[model samples]
Target: MAEQMGSCKYLFMSLLMLFQVVQCRVLTVSEIVDVKLPHQPKSFRIDLVHRDSLISPLSPGNISSTARWKRVLERSNERLRKFQLDSRSYSDKVSDIKDAQAPVSSGTGEFLMKLAIGTPAVSYSVILDTGSDLTWTQCKPCEDCYSQPTPIFDPSKSSSYSTVPCSSSLCAALPQPGCSKSSCQYYYTYGDSSSTSGILSYETFTLTAQKLPQIAFGCGENNQGTGFSQGGGLIGFGRGPLSFISQIGPSVGNKFSYCLVSTSDPPSKTSPLIIGSAAGLNAKTFGFTPLIKNSVHETFYYLSLEGISVGNKALDIPAGTFELDSGGSGGIIIDSGTTITYLKQSGYDAVKQGLDSAVSLPQADGSSVGFDLCYTSAAAAFPSITFHFKGADYVLAKENYLYHDSTGVVCLAMMPSSDLSIFGNFQQQNFQILYDLDSSTLSFAPAVCDSL
Candidate 1:
């Protein structure tokens, strides 16, 4: 069983970032094409290291007797609350393909990137979130900031640092709306009550041997709530115009892909996040799904989920449940920050029955676990679930579809949604998922993530 609250700190901060998407407006390069900048490397690699991989096995002295179970229940509650909040947020149809809340344990096992910011090159560990678009870090001279492991970055020491003026086109894209000051300022709040406010600026960003000049980033001087973690800040890789991909669009060719290790696997394993044209070679693995863009929320990446098949039979759910409608109806969203998958009610029920029929294990009560479809059986055979996308069928193994709780109960990892359905990162484990904005298509191919 996975430890829960241990990672809640990262979860809540990521939650705050995603929530800001709903309130902020993105002003992208299209609006500021005339702004000339410096040259950047055509392609390079950023080594990703998962913090969990560094942890030692929990000894008896490390955890209290009941603390483990309590953590599982608490984390489960966080997942339910997040699912409900995101369903409502997406249903509200804030005019995007969309926004979502992640499971609390997500950050505990998520991949982190080591980034070098400023001309002097101050380094910090940051979470890489495909679900969000803005890249920010806690800066020095803060009015109010959360505690971070690294010394807060002081932009004044960096020779290349320059604040974006309110008159600049990038400032107009900010969610802050009216700008009275010369510096472009942003105030972002999350559904969980955390907020970040700071000045927008461009800085030199370095990852290993590659150095990217004139990268736009938020230099947060005033941050509240889950503002920072051991992973000092977050790097958003969303489809938005202001996202990492968008900012590096010219160099990367708008293509990137990652293969997440199975959450059930030990954190000792790390994965690759191939950027630029190199990700294009992953297409040879097959199982290509056409990607869709939401007109309203340009940052979100959307995919059509045709149906889910249990074994050889498809569930008795309606196809329209996964369809993206302009009326803000139900649709499927793919997000990496989320640790579990969520299905609409009818679809969820059908899958549940299939599990109940296929596995002979007695159904364990899930009240304390915060979900349904759990059992006490060990090494039981679980019906493999295949998510039929637009043109590809991505099948999941027993390890990917089942959850082992703290109390020796194995439960279906997926949750039931009232309206919105999300393809969380958990299901994408060991799959090389390619996001290509150039062709507007996402592809997937199974691979041993550790080998990647």
Candidate 2:
């Protein structure tokens, strides 16, 4: 779970950066040519180190007796009631695939991770993204390029930098509005509104011991988002050949897995992303759930939920009404692009009543949540809510699991709609979430997300 959250933080930050640099111009290389991969084989390797320990078991000493963990389970029935209609808009479309099953929890585990990339220049701290598919970075001739913390990947400096001719087969697949000729040019737009422009290029790339045969990326002539300060480039996770994982996937392991840590957590103990066979889940030791492919968005996974229950009482929500996207958070956005999560008034009332029983509250506005439970003053006991799905229960920790702008502040991160519920990262902490594209299933396990 920690690892997944770490990846989510990267994605979220990328979105935020994208929103800030929406209308930047891209510089183009003078040479117009066909796009093709390098013919030589380049190799590299990476060393990884595990930085976190397993979470201790929940026990009497670890929890407060006065307020039982289960007692804190509350349903914002009223909030959910009002948002039901909106929730439907964000709800995931059910899949017809036989293996398409709802998300389930197994056991806790961890993995070793190493990310490497070959750029036109000596690129440092280039960001890797599992949620996107195009790999790109700021380059020379960036007349209006914004300043950033990391150095740009200059193709001209690299001994191996080579252009992908316009006629190459790889250039045909660039996700552009008019991808007709081989005049390889790419324009990418991220959810947060970050945009980059550059001509396409084919290069021999290396990640650890693995070397991808042919890879294409958007070499931005100019870029604008510099807040991240870590990398001037983005490695996309989409299905194109330029995407980071897909290019090396068949070689790295057969799949990749990530759990992003919440931004709210301290950065020192930040979680690391994992890929390939190094992923800690031992199939032989842990349970396996069928992967369900999404019919509508071929890139996403779909699961049929049985229900969600808080202790003995099951909230009255339709099964198969929610969808989880591992790439998104801040809150669960069951968005198909348009609708938002709508928690009905009844659901919000039920949830709030339960939460209010254990924690005090401050007034609220649409923008922020103030708190009654002060983390600095005293520790507050919280309830344990089980997100029941397909007969399995995924447990959530109190601190990282439920979050507010401030402690005890009553605000609408989870807004009231009508009847539907949308779960995001606020509810995703301490849970090992696995998005398996090969099997088409979103899996979860109990975890100590403090590190992620």
Candidate 3:
């Protein structure tokens, strides 16, 4: 009878363990699908929809998966070329303010925001760019302009629109400020040779049902570029004084955060772009890394990437491989507009070698898919990649680093760069990334962006 009781007890214990394992698995799946937000109120919240989303104004409707992938690669390559040129330009500092040039790009960003301008407010869709510094839109009286979906903004219709005089401090802040009979004139040339010429003006900007008056922006009269034709204009979120964030940073405590939903998820699921204090941040859950400063090029956010690891083994890379030199070269930048992560040639080589050794799957040709490292099997288990920032260790999920093309090709979502390394939006998906200007640090935590 004692032996029978002992056997029954063992059976009961096994059942309890099995029940707990099932319960944990269900909880984990639910957490991934639907993340709960903190109860605290957000200061300013905006919906950031992916450009490919059906609800977005810039959505490319019902294209083949292959065509869509090709387009994505093309845009990423163009943006990467722009960054490479910009790095050289930053190193070659010009003493004279007249010769100062700012590098700009059009229609390469993956996210779009719907914002209103003027006193009565005219709604327009614009590209969101962290790499750019000036907020601009196509204006009326077009000598040369691209065909945008929305009507051009006519400053004459807005009662609150006023051009900035050349003598104003704001006008002088422009890289290459011009004067057309006392009115401040601005000309911006993109890396792709696209250009925009217009008058600097102050107008009321509306975001998320809130009115922000006297925001300085460009009213482009002569804008010639295929990149600008896709959307109404571009909104700059760089660190420069004229950027939208810089102009409003003081009021918003110099803090901003964004959570990008995974591209694999439904495009209809929108991400959250928080402009003030972010919710659900703590020391235990979130990791912090210091933001390295680049006096020459202040617009880009630089970070010190110590090393990288594939699975559990660290890559054999030389020290200071990702360090920023005094001349503003060889640093990693976190960019919201870029789609894929780019690494310096040396670093890229090491990472690729590491991934090749760890992923035990048959190799596949990726040239047609726009990737270098690819595998044939989609169901094969893959190792996670971890980025070792100064004080933070960000471990990426398999979905973050591996791109499963619709044609049954699984490829690594990274590339080699000849210039500066970039931490692009693809690697940043599903993480709440907070840029704290006041603390000179960047904090991030894993999250389900759609729920946020």
Candidate 4:
């Protein structure tokens, strides 16, 4: 009788366990909907196409390599000239549109990005410029506008579009703010005398599948420029309160990253530009350099370039050669708009001397290719170049600093400047670059940009 009771108790316990399992599995519809999962960080990504790419509307199809390199150098020269002239303080405010002579230029940025704006999204191609501040696009009903391949963005069609009043703090953030009645107006002049004047407004910016609302931008009714004819307008990635990155900083955790593909790659291949939480960027793998601050010109991203190396030998560059002075004159900037890197005369000389000593190949004239250093043999092995930044050593692949022109001559892809030095897009190719404004750091790692 005792054994029978024990068996019955065991059966009861087994049935109770099975009932509990069934109860847990049979969740109500509302209860299932309310269940929480592990949190995942969100990121937005877009493609960055080279302007000369076949996929880009700006591409001059079938152009010779010599012609392409010449155009890049010309634009670089214009961009550097603008940077030199743009030394004015951002703190200075302009009371009216007439008083606004702000020095900001497109310099014919090499990369183009496609995004949509407004309530009913209208797609537009725009220059992806890291050196610029305000994101502006040519709008409909133009007073004066440059020729663009696509239809101009019509603010009237955008239901979500709204103009900022002159009294709003958003309007006050403009370097040179103007008042057209109660609406805030803006005027910006490029280095090449290209200009854009329009009302300051807020709209929804759709990048990829993500819709970012309430973004401050310019609706340029009067716009004139040579380089801007290819694309609709520009999207600024500069360090300023009015810049696209700054406007989206809160949502993105003040982080952004990009990987530029080599120009030698097929024009169809595209690089990726990411904002918010960047994936595959582990701190252990990336080398970081602190970003230097310039009080006078706050838009540009400055770096401390301690020195450079050719092969194994470090160039003997004088201290403070790349330093940003109290007056904000000399410094090194990483610019995405410029195709070829530019070093100050002194620094360039040191690098040129180092290359001359390291290279054993027969010397060739690179004047036609817009370079000072050239080698007759394109297939010959060459020494690697490395940029020595503070707390980081960035090694460059042969493709980064050397290019084989259409004439079958390999040339150094760097130039000399009188005042400012720029680390341009060529050197940055095939590298994943992360800009963390929160940490005040810039991190980079070698990557196959196309794969990323």
Candidate 5:
């Protein structure tokens, strides 16, 4: 039900409460080095793969931008509706919702990155999900698996592969575990009824030639699903213990940043995901904002959305419309996978009403038929829209965050949500966003992602 862009099927993360066990390595280990990249000595770049990219076999031909936006809004609402039905509760229930909503590839999610795992280092196109933690892939001896275009990872062939013993600390952290005789078994089920079960093992995760030793991930042996067949696996960047970031945060200074390009951009070249010591961006350019930690699930990067200003005027929206609660149900989250922004009803009304009043022209696109895009003959004459984050005043330029359709329509790439609000990827195009775990801060600056 949670979709970056969204797919036909709803994905659910199986993290049932565990009854535990016996063999694996401890958490801390030897220092790992960054891979040698041609540029940016300490930094490496990973290309951002768009959804249904023309270069990708799963993608159809380029559809109209108008059609794509329509689909995005529709998908956003559909997921939110499911979320409403699920009805976020206390911590445990909220975690279930997050798992239920996690992205599993297909046509609806955001960008995909080519990541490598194991000794021979097999490259896998994994969907990047900031909301998720466990990085997993369909592995060899796969009794059950999806029909992936790429080869399944064979750990037996990789020299660095090792099974995480049922007794390791990571096993304790596993949200839901199925007990087995020798090793830790993981059985995950998506909301759509798709499921994957496998062993928790240690593998060398390669990012840009860097052989990160002792990285723990799920070796999915029996996976039955209809979603995310295009890629080999999923990459979790959440704050949980098993996430790639949490595992590597110590060596990389607890900082990572990505400048997202438009999914409509050319597939050959797009944005880059930067990590390690290289993530110390210029503070003056990319101003900092204190990130709110979720009491329920610490994995999400929450931010307090104070208010919004249209034409340099702060709208008189209801107070506390964008509050970040410890429960994690309501709040604004900056997500990498979601394509469009979603504002809760109160915030939406204030912003929409302001924009409607400021713009002097009629909607050029189809709104009567249910669309969020708007148009104006004097689009330039329209005032600017600003988002007030805690301790920051982030600004959005027209072309940077808005889409100017072929029909000369200036559309707002955001809409209203009945449940939680999200600041999506479309609003993040060409901007560098840094998540510093150690400092508990999130920062952003305008960037030409294609050039970077």
Candidate 6:
């Protein structure tokens, strides 16, 4: 049986799917809707923990740089700890304030949307995530508890949702070797505490206008925890088919991408995550860099670093160091688990210095948040900070670097002086990032950000 062959004893079959080779072609922004993405098998999780010790291209070598990087990360750690304390200490105040500013739409929790899986119409709410992958949700039983913000997907109600036979070739290719059971039991754990477990099924899942004819996915029977609080389930962006975009592949579009605009920004102006092909990037203007082979899962996209720069001034550091992860949050999440952006010592220092020179904010006691600038007051225009990817310079927008917190406090710099540089969502949103699994190249171009 396919399931038995894909189990622990069938390591070869798993390897074939995980490392299958294919010739890759670059897709232009306009081609996003034109190309069909290949249906490649995705993986479960990274085996190793992402530690600060890992080299970042920007961080490179230089004892002072390393120390400074650590110092900044330490400060960030302290600030985050304090932020958590502040959150708990001023919980009531913050909560009340949030309630007053919260839009009527915000309180309703999940947003309901119809999803079609391989020609079958199934109703489900996809919890939009800027920070995760592996989209999944409740299905079948529809019976018990777990109050969801939107309606759950009923397989019987869907003409297309069907279970993958235990012996199917595709079913046996699940990354988690032994997990290819007849009943379809699979589990996934994220860098965050969020996780999901469910049975595999094939169906036609649809987005607003995007449609995947026959996509494979996990139809969770028991969806629980704070992770599922927002809606029916998650619509992950990570390199896994568990995500709607990943499952749809070349059939719907040749590639997948999204642009995350700020929530504070106007509704009409939204970030788009384009799958198959991106919309604004000029393929001719874009440069390419070798993507790191899955140091973890075959599905993840990674890049080896040489170094980074601010303008013409390049940070003196080692080459062939650092890795790029799209899954990071904030501006650049240097670490695997930490949610905030972790900048390299030089990058953080330069950015912070620029901010400090431009604006100022005061602590409760009037002592400035101690940065070159603080977000407590209205912001003044700051200098542009360009992240040097390989030899290309990718510029960041003003909004991409600054954010007003829940208290209307603007954070001039997203990362604390001490965190490792992680090109997080803040920086990522400005460019059209392409992860070519076949060629193992990470390519992007500046849309709002300076050209790369």
- Per-prediction TM-score: 0.80, 0.58, 0.86, 0.86, 0.82, 0.59
Off by over 4 Å in 5: 1-42, 70-87, 90-108, 263-265, 282-284, 364-370, 376-380
How far residue 284's Cα lies from its native spot in candidate 4, in Å, is: 5.0
In candidate 6, what are the lDDT values of residues 200-264, reduced to their tens digit?
A: 77777656545555566767776533434445565544454454545554453335443343324
Off by over 4 Å in 4: 1-41, 88-104, 279-284
Model 6 weakest lDDT span, ten residues long? 43-52
Output the lDDT of residue 254, model 3. Answer: 79
Cα lDDT of all candidates, in order?
0.70, 0.43, 0.84, 0.84, 0.72, 0.45
TM-score of 1: 0.80
For residues 68-102, write the lDDT of model 2, one tens digit per residue: 11211111221222222212323331221123232
Residues 333-445, model 1: lDDT tens digits: 78776567878888889888877877777888866656678888857777788888989898999888776776678778788877767787768888888888888889888
Per-residue lDDT tens digits for candidate 3, residues 96-129, read: 2235244235557888888999978999988889
Candidate 1: segments with Cα more than 4 A from true spot: 1-40, 55-109, 178-180, 227-230, 281-284, 367-369
Summarize candidate 4's per-residue lDDT along 283-378 as a digit string, tens digits. Answer: 458789998888778899999999999989999988889988888878999999998899999999998888878877778988896789998887
> How would the candidate models be sorted by TM-score, starting from the highest?
4, 3, 5, 1, 6, 2
Query: Which candidate leads the pack in lDDT?
Result: 4
Clashing residue pairs in all predictions, respectively, total 3, 86, 0, 0, 13, 49
Higher-scoring candidate on TM-score, 3 or 5: 3
Tell me each candidate's RMSD, in Å, in order: 16.6, 19.1, 18.3, 8.9, 15.2, 16.1
What's the TM for model 5?
0.82
Comparing 1 with 4 on lDDT, the higher-scoring candidate is 4
